[model samples]
Target: MTSIPWLTILVFLPLVGALLCLLSWHSAALCRWLALATSWGVFTLTAGLFAAFRQGGAGWLLYEDHAWIAPLGIRYTLGLDGISLLLVLLTGFLMVVAVLVSWRVTRFSAAYFALLLGMEAGILGVFLALDLVLFYLFWELMLIPMLFLIGIWGHAGRAPAAVKFFLFTLAGSLLMLIAIIGLHLVHVEAGGAPSFALEALRGTALPARVEPWLYAAFLLAFALKVPLLPLHTWLPDAHTEAPTAGSVILAGLLLKTGVYGLLRFGLPLFPNAAAASLPWLAVPALVGIFYAAWIAYVQTDAKRLVAYASVAHMGFVVLGLAAWNQTALEGSILQLLSHGITTAALFALVGMIDERAHTRRLDELGGLWGRVPRLGFFFLLFCLAALGLPGLNNFVGEIMILIGAFQTRPWWGAAAFVGVVFAAAYMLRLVQAVLWGPPRRRDFWPDLDVREGVVLVALALAALWIGLYPAPLLQPLQAPVADLLGQVPLGPGPGGVP
Candidate 1:
């Protein structure tokens, strides 16, 4: 709709910056500054786009299309709607934090920073690309950088962890590719051009049996990324081994890709089947909440604890998605944002602690309050938020989810309520071990430096801002979500999405 090609710039600028960082690999400091500047520049553009966005229509806020592989009807298409805007903003913001957190890395630091920038580009591409092929390209782009980050920069078992992660994700993606090809062929069979553009492929009627199978393929692909329940084995290992920046990107942006894929392509393209799949979906999601909580509470390693907690948190988001109403969907989207912030903050803090004290084992960490009260305080704040403390970001999302789930199925709502209680228990257990339980070390650790303080405070402020006043975030989601849910047979909420 706009001639400026803003979405292209937003998606690829970091990629260009990555190249620049590699070229300047002679100095890590130069690369660091470049990554910081590039990430923030993207964030500034994201903020500007938000300010410029108008909400009168249910279509893309801005769209761009260009010829690419024209003979096959494939095109370079990118679009920005409210849903994309939020996720892209999240990617840009966390990327800045990732660079800052990794400021101390000296081993191939320039390469490290380059990979981080490349990660941002890949993630932004996934959120923006309107062509399924382009989307998959970006999706795989995310994998290579992440694999290197975990295997090269991570800890003792990084090798195996990286392998597990790569294998699981690739297997799921291959299945989804088959599904994408299936959809494209279906479109062609229906007298449409051979297009992989989401816009064209959408609504090409599937045979009753084929629809469910294709939908299941997309579901598994996204779920593996969401890493839901039993499929989530790679995350704890990946989180435990990855460097701090890698962990932040993993929790902050990488995990969201699955949920975003569902919202963007899976649900809308196969609405009735998606809605119908909820009953089966709910079982694993509900079970995963308790399973994650139980495993998280018993963990000795702090990072792995947060890793399992991520599974539980995402389970809530999955449940909200299964509910399929506007309230539940909105809550799912908000929780996606909230979980990204709180979990990334926690991992950052945990990484900082490991840097200081040489251990992430819960038994070895206590009395942090007496040594580093500033760090202790921020840790406590984010932990409470993770546990759904009232007036905190996660709570608002959790409450709305319960209400929405209750309206659709009271048992679902009640089950979620119990899950929240479980969340509080394990989350507080972590707080007790790290912040208030007992001193694992009497040696003093330095308090937050200016840079560290800046990162935590920024995360804290975002949590509080959204927790206390979520209207800004909620307002943009209204039409986009309405439009998304409108595709299903239950009812239409607003205009079309693709």
Candidate 2:
């Protein structure tokens, strides 16, 4: 372990704050301030971890372990390599911003902050936990707070969306739980002590007969969370109804957990299954790429439109992962981070619009760019990045994914290329209508306030930083990426393989 107990401190500090806030429930201001302090503290710790991380190693660093349920081989374990470290930081960064954004939600305010802090703790634990059971505990823990966020604090029809979201997630996770137990049994049967540590389980080779089913269960759980294709119907409603902070976290962090699980567990633990399912996986990803972009083009609601674009962007992520090469996996991770930052910004922008104008309908929006040029500009920047414009974060990841896709099959790249064009169409349409078209109400349009500007600027800076110099992000991930790839037997080189 590293000299600093970085992972534990970063993960649990928010939970501590959550408990403290609950203890001091009568003082809303105190609770809000404490929540913000805790979130900022986590972010600062993540910054410290970033500054201290060692790059280009064969395995993760700062690993910690202790027996939790020794009889069943479960342990309390946590660690981070570069990939997870970035996400942990992203979570920490957004939690603070979410607090800032929600500063004025005074109705049930203390409870709200407490739930928010608790949610952040669960999400951070999900990213940092190395034990399977530990990961699932965090995974399920997020559900309660988010349900409250959407149901208690959301808009009209919030209950339905919240219930739908809960049921879908619960069902998927249950299936995944079954798979986890099965994997543990396989490990035990292999003459290895039963263990749920990701590293320990990786050593057990799943039989070919059961690999596909187990892979399907695992992928289904993750894909449903990613809300891929057919499973994605709940997202638009959830986003449309969720509170601004909830929407931001959902788009930014919650969705990524699915893709993260796919990368961290799915491919590496069941490499042969992943390879076998590659053809099927690649098809939906490619189809979703174009379909989501087209749907986004037609959405009248700005938030729903952004929601659809997330589906489209995640298609690129799925394509990269299914491609199963170093470049593609790296690109997928980069895309995940880029999508998190940009999409969260977009949602936050929409939230600001709704807060001011009381609606998110595109037709009801117009000529704000002149009134809110600063806000419009930042929105445009994120929009361009979302569309994968060159010299932006999404572009880098998309290009890398495409390069990796092409290496696997030329047609996959070709399909993704078409999706890119559709993205341009919808995004430009959004930019034109909302920012530059005829004024909906010249008298009422107002520019961003100081707090809104702070949120947008912070997200924009992150997007630009990653867009310009991905090397820092990629370097630490190299070892883990290679470590993951080594588990899969990807046959011979391009020209040499049978």
Candidate 3:
């Protein structure tokens, strides 16, 4: 164990920045610089952690534990496995991007930056925390800042969108809280020490009768965050109404938390339950893939279209997780990272376009290639990535997912293959409408500014890096994912258990 508490520093650094931003509420420039510098510092620290990280080492790294509420057996514990380290890096990277993109937010600037930093802190903590209570606190802590971001700084319909987002997430969280407490109670009842420690709880076997219900509670909370299928209505509205930075964070970081929770907590904690629920979960994931794609095809609002595309993309992630094999799970994690980079870039592009054009409707956006070639080119690159073009980040993850899903169930793979086709169709349509169609307005639209180009290029480079060389990313995930799969008993052949 390193004596320095690197994980604690990583988690709390953003909170410290937010406090500074709050203190300098009158100076927007100082606030922006503080938030940006803080975010970049966090990213730099994360890179250091990654450099020190040993691939295929023990499942948890940089472990930190401290007594808290000793009478109730609650402890403040934080650690990172390969899966979490990747997410922490993603969170830090996106926080920098969010700060950069929000450079234009002049309304209540200090509060806005403060909330953004606070949200980043919460997200980092959620990825790092090892105790159930600590995890839940970080989880709920994310909600308040996000709610304020949407409600205070978003478009005209922001109020309702924020409320819907809150209610859906809150309801799901309450269920998870019940499950968390119930799991601890089960530990106590089983004559074990009562603890909210995840590893400890994972060892407590509940009665088969109660396991399914408890698993369902956790699943519902995560699914809503994933916003899988029927539980996904709030996502489009929230994404469409939120400000650019808000949408970027929501798409890039928040959505992944759902999938992460499932892999980190839900599956291992209730292996049998997760195994049995695979088929049931697979159906909704498959449904979300096609349904969201179809909806995206008909959307006029460009932002809303991207929002729907997120649903379809995340559907692949859920399906991959349900497969519960090393290949599929690793692909699912890659998809989480790739989707975050690609989707956040797309949302950022849309925001930039909207800022200039004062509109996001596809009908109003055409022939941008002539006006803003730089912007159009980057948009095209991310679009190709989003559609899973070969040699792009999205392709690697999607192909691995399909192959893994096939190994589990031929039809599951086939259906997901069809979703890929749907993805290409809708994404191309979006491309054609926004970039190649006849000009809608004769007014000159400027290409990306230096700052904007830097943001898009950085994101594109990440996508390109992942696309060409994924071995480093894949290697780290192997042990953690294999550990997760080992928890679920397998049959002689594929798809035998479910």
Candidate 4:
């Protein structure tokens, strides 16, 4: 029973489901139902994993390792720690949301569902893979399906958006590949058996001069995906052009991978370099927080506004990571989960609105509160959460991040506080315009049906759970985050406080 390979099954189950989806190519109904069932099964299995999980465990749990690509010393390794565990769970939950939101897709439905399942598999593998090479394989696997999702099924500007996304991601990926190969070469030269396994390579001393360059390569790759600052141009375009399911997955899951990469690989692999580069990273994060918030405040398109809001929210995650403290890291992780749920819900609502009104223009939408009371309530709930209102999910994460940042540097905290204010301004404006502004049309708009209500209610409950008591999530993260911090060269206990 101990040899059941649960992690392997979790990672591959969606890919198997995708194959099954292809078999029902002519039957869109079967394809949709099968995809929904498979995703829900995965979510249920993840819950089981959670129930059986040993809290406060020191290292990876449900560990499995196998030899692969012997010449390069890569292994088919998978495992979960507190950090990856939450992310894998988020991935599973969001896959269900993504599939449900796409329930109405009628054109090329089979291929669409299959691609969704395929992307879910890749995202799961990314969260679970412990081998660097295997991680890269999963990382690349996530791109293709998303590319097609945007290009084939997205809005009017899908083609250009898809191309832009592919190019930016490809450029970053190439740099990351170079860094991975460089690390392997360095290991071989150090008279060690070449290995791309994380445990094997972690803290492996590299030449001081070469280390910074390698860190930069990885940082650039991840920052681009985090789409940090100037590197974030592709995100708005991608979000605006993608279909509802694509946007939900992009905002909820794919973006988190970049932050995950930073925590998992960037800092731990090159602590000294990471410490040296903190200000460089933190400044752009701070700037992006304000920059994106201001841009979001002025957007005409509803989805585009939400897209920019993602940039601002993710900036907080970056800032927390740069702070390099346990509280900050834990807050960043919570932000990851909270942002995934809240933002995905927002996107789903926007999709519903677009479906009804056939327009995302803010000026064109108003006074919907009277027509779609259920949707209005959920929209306001998620909006409040997004703006960091007290007792909501985003508030908890943001407060912790600021507290942690202030401990590291008061000025960083102060600057980020301004971002919080701007967040409230922009989000409130959105709520006011979409729900209470003058009605652009008098036609009756339908409230959420049972399926949509179920989705929103589930997300609302998750948000409330985190806001009221984050300890369940925070407790599991403490041990792993503390362990990760131990590897870094900064902070009070590391011989010198930064």
* Cα RMSD to the true fold for all candidates: 3.3, 2.0, 1.6, 1.9
Ranking by lDDT: 3, 4, 1, 2
Candidate 1 matches the true fold with a TM-score of: 0.97
Predicted candidate 3 versus true structure: per-residue lDDT over 1-498, tens digit per residue: 488999999989999999999999989899999999999999999877877783746568779999999999899999888999889989999989999999989889999999999999999998988899999999988878999999999999999999999999899889999999999999999998979999899999799899999999999999999979999999999999999999999999999999999888998899999888876788999999999999999999999999999999999999998776778889999999999999999999999999889999999999988889999999999999999999999999999998888888878988999999999999999999999978898877788899998899899999998999988788778778878888876543355213
Q: TM-score of each candidate?
A: 0.97, 0.96, 0.98, 0.98
Tens digit of lDDT per residue, candidate 1, span 226-275? 97888999999999999998989999889999999988999888877887
Better of 1 and 3 by lDDT: 3
Backbone clash count, each prediction separately: 0, 0, 0, 0
Model 1 poorest ten-residue lDDT run: 489-498
Q: Candidate 2 on 1-498: residue-level lDDT in tens?
A: 377676887778988998888887888888889988999998998877777783546677678888899999899999888888888878989888899889788888878988998899889888888898999999988767999999999999899999999999888889889999999988888899879988889878778898888888999999998878888988888998999899989989999999888878887788888767765788888888888888899999999999899898888998988777888889999898899998988998888878777888989888878778888888788889988878888998999898887887777877788889999999998898788877786566678888788888888888888899888888888888887778775654342111
Per-residue lDDT for 403-485 in model 4, tens only? 88888887788889999999999999999999996788987788899999999998999899889988878877988998988
- Models ranked on TM-score: 3, 4, 1, 2
The CA lDDT at 325 in model 1 is 87
